[model samples]
Target: MRSFVVSVVSISLVASAVFAHSGVKNEDVMKRMKQMSEMASNMKVLGAMMKQQQPFDLPLAKAAISKIGELSAETGKSFATKAEDPKSEAKPIIWDEFDEFTKLADALTKDALQLQSSLKGPEDLRNVMATLGGACKQCHSKYRE
Candidate 1:
């Protein structure tokens, strides 16, 4: 399980590197990528706090989770259109499997909200990381390049 999480993070880094050089020029895809990037940034904050790499900040983590949920709600709107630029990490499968893609986004929103409410501190937050990470990996593996 731990190895799997590392692999997911590895793939994300590799994909980001590949896209950075891919010369993506589409504004729409860029918007979608930005949304995902923001979520990733928030996740890092939460991970740092939960893992004890940083001091726990409950209000800050909750705020980040709320932002993640907000971005998640806009996910379907962002990716529903087809405008793949060279720099896009999104796959064609997103449009082909639109329903499933939206479902995954909805699931993430739900997870974020639930985690926000249920997590009281670092220990509770740590326990929810697997479920949170798994939700992200599911969409990423299927929809992202």
Candidate 2:
């Protein structure tokens, strides 16, 4: 009886391991999620700087915008390759409307690039920030929880 119980427990453990490997690990998805969260935080800081009409720190704004663009690109690539990752916060609607998600990601990339290019002055930066915010809202409303 003890041997049979041990065999059953070992089989359960192996089955769970197989199930766990079948889906994305939470750690991997959380890493990417944290990156996206950080990018959003940086964008918020840029927005606050713009609001204060600070001297338009070109280098800082450039770095922040570039990072945001990079994050957007990474998200797009991830969705393309591993859209079905079990740990993804992305809704099922995202996969159902995959083309739309791609389009939004492309739009985000364009908006970020535009913001990076037009970071000439405070007003231009504000305009770009507004555009970026709109793009972000549009995507989040549809895809993110």
Off by over 4 Å in 2: 1-25, 53-55, 81-88
The residue-by-residue lDDT of candidate 2 on 7-63, one tens digit each, is 675576556544544556665555556666656666765875688634457787888
Q: Model 1, stretches more than 4 Å misplaced?
A: 1-22
Per-candidate TM-scores read: 0.82, 0.71
Supply the global lDDT for candidate 2: 0.71
Compared with the true structure, all predictions reach lDDT values of: 0.82, 0.71
lDDT of 1 by residue, 1-145 (tens): 7558656865786578456645657889878877887788678878877777667888988988888899999999998788888777788988988999999999999988988898787788766677778888999998888
Per TM-score, the best of the predicted structures is 1
lDDT, candidate 2, residue 85?
A: 55
